[model samples]
Target: MNYELRLYLDQLTAKSASIELNSTYARAIYIVEGSIAIKNGVSTRLTLSQNSALSIPESFSLGGGSADAIMLRWELVNEVDNSNKIQASQSTLLLAAKMALGDLSQYIIRCDRVDFPPEGEALTHRHLGGGIRCLLFGSIQIHTLGNIHTHQPLSAWFEAGPDAVYAATDKTLASAFARVMILPRGLIGGKTSIEYVNSEDKNKPKSQRYQIFIDELIQH
Candidate 1:
């Protein structure tokens, strides 16, 4: 249950603004805007762009581009003994899957950002995996099994299990960034990890389709 969240906005403006980090836990780097270069060791370098993310196993150093950049970084240490005691709300059982998979220790971690336009809403859907979400901008509301919660910027929440409906909290635009780690069963290459109960919405445009929305986030 050891984790750390670091927020850096417009901090990386030059090549000399590099920072070194050493952790025994796994780390995820989220590129909110602009780009950054990460170096783990000699001959290993990664360039992450806007809306994209990457997770590294241990220690590394990262720096930004000539232009200012915004990024959110998370460092998590997996504690098998504490897997069953996940901290989250009553509506979401965010760590249930992790507890189930702890013995096997086989899972994949995926991270991305999702955006909802003003008044935009999505059909009721559920994910096959559990993860944590942090509101980066605007406000968001989540509906799960009769439970509803509104979240504000810089606020974090957990999506427990995979059987909840999430939507925009209000009439305004909102966006959330999340890093999810799930067992292999949750995601198979080229296939969706979400199950939408209402698949056919003739009135909804294809571009606004729930499946399409999630696909774009995963692909990005």
Candidate 2:
């Protein structure tokens, strides 16, 4: 079935505060700033810090931190109408894409961080699945569709799988970005999503480093 995939930035004032979620869709929550405790009906509570993330179907509200807390939420919607359901106090939609999502059992939902040191670059390559990326720090340039686009911290962009692209980070300082991708189930626990365009480029040195936060089977 076709589905709409979305990414949002949510902010909470303090403890006892709450945010609504789509219980029918699978979700990936990443703590962007401050801290929050996750509590559910069964008393299963989990605390997440900066850069931490998890995959869950239910959201019981988030609160508790010295100041306002922020989170990046990825939601998978089975219907187009439910894709834009917004809560008055929830989050701002960063981006959305409609996906055919061929076989629910053959895909996995994942959240990961790609960090690049000063002067780092990701060579021309393509991914196996489509996803969106939101900058975490520093600046980056993405080359695709015969054009180059620059993005700052908090800025977001979408990458359609199979399109060749190259990325370059800030030259004077370090850069990092957090991204969520819908990948093949075969990629579970492994990092084989990127495919360099040139066969000879495969032997070239790489400057980017990866750290995965969550990788789980996608649920319908």
Candidate 3:
């Protein structure tokens, strides 16, 4: 299953564009433009504006009530677990990890949100970690040793295998925030292990999965 990550920005006006939620996948909605209203399955509605986000379950119905608004939505690609409950009515960017997916691996993933004050690249460091990164918030131009790329909202990039060192510089003064999901690359040749190496663990030559779960992750 393929997950969808989207970013809506600078939408001048829209009549009424909405999509119904499917039970197989969950959704996360965030407003970036004008004021908008979202309806689940009940009479109650959720009103969101700039900086506000909403979580929509697959069983719920989501639609727009205003025109010319920018909204972002993330639909989960996996099935639901027995521990999760579907909220018929609500709109927020935050969603439970277990509810979005059946597994607990979603909680093990690390999400890094970076915000630069006035001057960009306040500090630069050599990072020894690699994984799938999704830009959920602001826009950032990342320049690594390999190449330079611009990461906008809802853009995901994956780094296969391990042993990759990279650094990121915030090219925009607006601040750059993104979600990084560590993949489950087994160290001990087990399904539950993850391959991670630090300055201390570099010489060990072993991988550790560490009971990590990736059931749910923030769309960022």
Ranking by lDDT: 2, 1, 3
- Quote each prediction's TM-score: 0.65, 0.93, 0.49
lDDT of each: 0.53, 0.83, 0.41
For candidate 1, write residues 1-220 as lDDT tens digits. 3232222233365454556666533446666667888888877987877767776646577776655666655434444323221123201222222323442234445565666666656567776766666666767777888898888765666665567685755475545545444425336443656567776753455223221112111210
Angstrom error of the Cα, residue 117, model 2: value is 0.7
TM-score of 1: 0.65
Error of 3 at 144 (Å): 5.1
lDDT digits (tens) for residues 24-84 of candidate 2? 4567878888887777766677788888998886656566555567888888777555633
Model 2, which residues run further than 4 Å from truth? 64-66, 79-90
In terms of lDDT, which candidate is strongest? 2
Worst 10 contiguous positions by lDDT, candidate 3: 206-215
Displacement of residue 68 (Cα, Å) in model 3 is 1.9
lDDT, candidate 2, equals 0.83
TM-score (C-alpha, index-matched) for candidate 2: 0.93
- Which segments of model 1 are wrong by more than 4 Å? 1-13, 23-26, 80-100, 103-105, 169-178, 197-220
- What is residue 103's positional error in candidate 2, in angstroms? 1.7
